[model samples]
Target chain A: MSEKFSLSIEDLHVSYQLSGSAGKNKIARAVDGVSLQLHPGETLALVGESGSGKTSIANAVMRLLEPTSGKILLDGVDLVPLQGSELRAMRRNFQMIFQDPFESLDPRQRVIETVMEPLEIHGIGENQEQRRDLALAALAQAGLRPAADIGDRFTHQLSGGQRQRVAIASAIILKPSLIIADEPVSMLDVSLRAGILRVMADLRDQLGVSYLFITHDLSLAWMFADRIAVIYLGRIVEEASAVDLIENPMHPYTKALVSVIPVPEAIEGASRTILSGEIPSPSSIPSGCRFHPRCPLFRELGEPEKCLNEDPLLQISAKSESHLVACFFSDPSKGDTQ
Target chain B: MSLLEIRDLHVSYPNRKGEFFAVDGVDLTIEQGEFVGLAGESGCGKTTLALSIPQLLPEHSRIAAGSISFNGVDTTALNEEGLRAIRWKEISVIFQGALNALNPVQTIGSQIQEPIRIHDESVSKKEAQDRTLELLEAVGIPSHRASDFPHQFSGGMRQRVMIAMALSCMPKLVIADEPITALDVMTQAQILDLLRSLCDKYKLSMLLISHDLSVLAQTCDRVAVMYAGKVAEQGPTSRVFGSVGAQHPYTQRLLRAYPNIRHERKFIDGIPGYPPDLSTLQVGCRFADRCDVALSRCATEVPDLIDIGGNQSVACHLVSENQVGVQ
Candidate 1:
């Protein structure tokens, strides 16, 4: 059972209390009853725009933010109840890679020191020399050749791609079974981002590591992830295989997102579904569907009265075992049946 | 005649070790009512080139050579007073980092009104306020929200305010440097659509600078690929990124790196090496070290921009030699 999956999040809810101008507090449900599962060596991308709780989900999983309630089961062991040394020991099984490599790494620390910090903190290596050797090996594995020379230089001395490689080395040095990467290559140049993606994919293949890859860019997720979960507001709106999600999106939000992505091809006369308004604030999330206000399909479907009252739960498609969507109007038998 | 022309422009900043050439020998032109895009990675001198057009370079930077002509007027030779007259009146810039660019304490209305008032003293305060409301409405923001401060607005609204401010005077040309870089996908699409529509409505020539190639392809009529402070390729967007693909090795590599939603999934090949250090002068092509199609002569002889017909040009020795043989 649960051991088959690398990480499983059950009914996760992360809320924050914000004080208003009048000193009254309001609860912001960043991650509202979200659930996901990542198998061994699989990449599950949580895709969404800002304020969509993608990063909140990652933070909650990483234990950087405490969740209001949820069960985070890693290898059949519940992580929420762990504390002190037990939690510290559990951290080695899960690691995180942040968005901006320049800011993530300490400027004063050398590359070797940055990567070795995790090993030293966890008391993995017996001696400093052994730790240095392991750090250099991880750097080599991360595609930074002449690892000794690279290890001697400070983070500022390296290029953006190289700095990201260092970040990856640090994350993989612990050989974590799961890596929570939050927009890991978003800050790097387009020419440089592909290299980092290749490195991560290669590392996953070699180390059998799963990833909770969270990003705003759907194209990147489509390129790398095994499965894609589209989140809107604070809930999973759609989930499917990468190919299925991109080729045939069932949810209106996912369809709009897919259409808006700027493809390299000319795509002449391709009609784009432009949503009218910006994402609403999390504190005052819209009632019912949560996306009804800006959903173009909501109007196209003749303004379903049910969308304004009853929220749809995520349901597995009858056509396919893997595809799941949380929309009342998205009938699985409509088009491209599986 | 061209709306704007930059010939052999050289801009540098004084570092501890002599001058660092942020924008080396570069030549570019924008036709009237044309939308041109400048695409490059960070530190590739795209921003420096845009800043040089408006004489808005930072304090330590110096214009080392060449001239910038706007509507046949040599902008580089203009005096301070003359340049100020042409800045917001003839050309305006929508700077990057829209959130920090707007003043926090001031209302969006006042900031949009600043340019309108400064450029024309004849315009009254009431008139300027009316024009601010008009500009806000044009950029898709509500006119009533003009009184709201920047912090009250979302990221997308702040960007719309920036666009409104740039359109306040209705200059002949607009230079937007990474306007939608920090925004989300939906917000980015909205801004792009607004920019395209606004450009059409006003018939304004635009220089849209961004590191994202897909963005450039979506917005611009022509695209110039910049690398290591130089234009590696320049052509119509259709030909530059057409079925045949970009001719310059760097341009092709860059285009290949981006994941196209229309295309099937495949492993994207990344450019292997880092960009050359700007301070150290190189004899041959700056991209020779990382280029896979580099010939032996690429390390010794610099390649000049060669016209490859169909309004497309490339600065690669291999491409130029192949074109010569075909001719």
Candidate 2:
């Protein structure tokens, strides 16, 4: 166990049996043997397309959903083995801020009430007034100006950005060790997105809270996260520092994903590797490389026998020491596929 | 001749209080085979401008002043019948959300067929079906999936289906309003690539409206930067975004704020204040209140869009004078 590591998922495997009569008692693996570590006071972004099980992994970390197998270690304790009331106590250490702020907050509750809910639930505060004071302090920290005036207002009265602030304030009111933000700014307007990201960044510095930021936007991931893990078909295909991942992506899946991002000012249109087909369903994932069906490099390499049949384990690529990718090519710059 | 031309267009809406000009004194030209991007934050009247082009505004809204010409015909003067005749045949639209735009009850294939049937009454149902599937294939959707309902597809697939439906009648000009805003980064890239290829394949002129500067940068040939319903800057996409000369306060903040992988050590302070209440009529510049280094003159008089050598137009008092450069 690393003391500096705030969160760690070791060989996590989450599965659910097929629902209703259609289920022949077969398992649908949503997250299959995925693992990553988030250091204290750092942001680790999980970037992937929708239905890539990014949110599933987040839920497992927050203990909202129990992982079917493997260990979830938080602060040197294996959360997987904990059960009943003990697990509930451990759950308080990590909080989750959802994507839709409008739906997440209780409609009838005031801002102050919403923020103080966590404190009341934990029975940590001395009294109602003490909880109210703590809630107001959290509100002020999240940059809700004139905090006293806004605390009594309903969620509807506040703008999208303000609602998000309230949500953040509530998540941090308990002063949790790790915050799992699942696409927090996806619903916000373009300009407001930056503000929300900045608030999260500031909170990380102030409270020393680690973040597991899940989003589909790589550009944002590049900006906010110290390290990034690229998930494809419920598996982390590549994981590296933000700089290494962006500058020299090794995996064919990662390279394809990175090339699609539209650079704001670049005049020359960089050619993208157009994946030939749609992402395969989770039930029928490709055997060797989950991305091989849509991977242009794999097709060009013309080794379907091994490339599509033998599963490749996560290994160090030739790009950088910290960078790791799940690809047989080893060196992408050498044109192994070509 | 330009495919679409607007001269001094003014669109206004009346509420319980008073009349507010959402699109005021705006002029633009979309030449044949040109892809022009309309960029602005929410409530900046970018959508209002797009709607006004097709006379698709709500009952409260009216074309208070100006002329909109499409293919040498005045669109503002067209009656309901005349507008209906030209709506899909000349200029089509792909709206923000495809799921909302699509008919839930009807099969996507039939919905597409309905448009082509309406456009050419003499066409047989079999012909329409064949054409619909062909259009679907063109937009990169599986032709067989056209038989499926809108609810069956994902967000990205529905958008592609929307593109197919928009181009079914083969309109010369397409107005896509925030087409990819609802999609993920990868899907957004795929949709943009599809649009780019479709536009090139058919030589279609497009009016792309979006707040995402990066998407606009990739898909559009020319970009129009709008603030409060007026185009603050319009020019070649590369010049407007790449160079410091085309920097407006809003544009500069936009470039800096969005998290791009390429840039480093950049700290963007959020635009301090909110957008002005359009209902409260403004005599001076609408952005003057929020502009960081606003001069006294900015509060007194509105600055016109000054041409900066090239075709770029910027409506900032400070940037027009080259006072601040992009750091």
The candidate scoring highest on TM-score is: 1
Clashes of 1: 0
User: What does candidate 1's lDDT look like per residue over B11-34, in tens digits?
Assistant: 999988899888889999999899
- Return the top candidate by DockQ: 1
**Which ranges in model 1 have alpha carbons more than 4 Å from their true place?**
A1-3, A332-338, B15-20
Q: For candidate 2, give the lDDT.
A: 0.84
- Candidate 1: which docking quality band? medium
**Per-model i-RMS in Å?**
1.2, 2.0
Error of 1 at A47 (Å): 0.7
Query: Model 2: per-residue lDDT, tens digit, A1-338?
Result: 43657888889988877766645676777898998888889899999988788988998887778899988889878998888889878777899889999999988989999999999888878999999999999999988978888899998889999999999999999899999999998887777877888889999998899999999988788878899999988899899998888888888888888888777874685787656556665666778877777777677777566677877777776666688888877475545442
TM per candidate, chain B: 0.97, 0.94
Q: After aligning candidate 2 to the native by TM-score, how far in Å is the CA of A209 from where it should be?
A: 0.6
Query: Lowest summed lDDT over 10 consecutive residues: which window, candidate 2 chain B?
Result: B318-327
Docking class of 2: medium
